[model samples]
Target: MGPDDAFWEDGEWVSWDEIHQQIQYKEWRAKWPNADLSLVPVFEDLISVAEDYFLATGRHLQVYGDIGELYAAITYGIRLHKNFAQGSDGRLGNDHIEVKTIAPMNTKDQTSVKLSGHFNKLLVVNISEEFEISSRMIDRASLPKTSGNILKIRWDDLA
Candidate 1:
């Protein structure tokens, strides 16, 4: 209905978690009453707040909210977390998400077999890339292995 509305409707969205600083849990709760905070507006408000916080403090904030709620928000380019969700899926739709299990392992190098999951026919991306994997993380699941750390994961399983 307005120029700004039109701009948003057609605009490309950047992930909120990628750019925001930590949110004060108490402040966030005070501002967003449950059942009333729509995804886009919340994300926009958080980004704006984060920008200011970063300018004044020179640091990014980690937001605290239900992971499921946050996951649902980022699909439209907004995300809230103390740490950005590490993964390539973007948490949008099955087309870009997947669930995998590690293969069994012995005491050799390390190998894994991706079990089942859903993802867009496009390439699967790793979310953990943003986080540091500990050296002590020694197990089949410590790291995921696809043909090249990514592939076109199956899509029906997510449902």
Candidate 2:
């Protein structure tokens, strides 16, 4: 299939309605049901931007990955650190947090999670094929030894 066809078939093209129905959105709402609705317009705008980029380039952007990280950071009240030699993605008080996203449907076998830098805590965000979101947090000290830069923990190990 052509890139455009593949992009569509792969479900990378997202709409505001689809995003709103996602598990991440539900989780956000459950936590902050009283949050102002004004934030939604910005989210809708971001969806449009992602869709436009895909249509013009026929390449799936990392918007969903970014969204996953942002969602996790906001939920945990963590601040995203700059990627300049930073070992972690966000900071929770004095601890470092590494956020990882997994879309099982997009992979044949997603085994070990990868780490870029040292972190005190690890957050695994799993997005299922149906857009259901689930997460887990583990301490770096409890994990197995690292092979090169990869953690020895497998996807099943986290379950």
Candidate 3:
């Protein structure tokens, strides 16, 4: 696992890439029984838009990134709950989740994991230069104390 793929799981660091790969493998097995989906395209248009937005604006667009988060939630069978506040990105089972995405290549600051309101869980999604994606799911209680609206945890802590 790369440094960027590290995430705390069961009190130990694990590779989000490996977890996601396992999920995908199980999904494929359940969906197609024995057939392979190697040629299937997943979020081609959205990924193109994300890449274009980053290239043109020199920053990661929130809407495009949110779309990626939504895709991840769906893939993992999480239900989305939209609201203006309260950090309601989606829900995994009974846990209220807040999804945050960052493209490491687009920003120099590694302390961008900001949060407001309340959430049971935080999902930090990291997108690499090659558009490879990984995520870290952290319980809000495990996070450090917040100052004002920002959570104490940063990108460096997760990445």
How far out, in Å, is residue 72 in model 2? 0.9
lDDT of 2 by residue, 76-143 (tens): 66677775646878878888888877653446324354566778898877665444566778888877
lDDT of 3 at 30: 86
Kindly report which residue pairs in candidate 2 clash with one another.
Answer: none
Ranking of all predicted structures according to TM-score, beginning with the best and ending with the worst? 3, 2, 1
Report the candidate with higher TM-score, 1 versus 3. 3
Q: Global lDDT of each model? A: 0.33, 0.63, 0.63
Residue 154 displacement in candidate 1 (angstroms): 24
Q: Which ten residues in a row have the lowest lDDT in candidate 2?
A: 1-10
RMSD of each: 16.0, 12.9, 14.4
Q: What's the residue-level lDDT of 23 in candidate 1? A: 48
Candidate 3 deviant stretches above 4 angstroms: 1-42, 52-62, 83-85, 109-116
Instruction: For residues 1-159, write the lDDT of model 3, one tens digit per residue.
Output: 446878777878788877887887687658545333342234445666777887889876556455546555545555656555555677777887777776546464233445664578877776777666667777878777756666544556864
Compute the lDDT of residue 70 as modeled in candidate 2: 58
Off by over 4 Å in 1: 1-37, 63-117, 121-147, 150-159
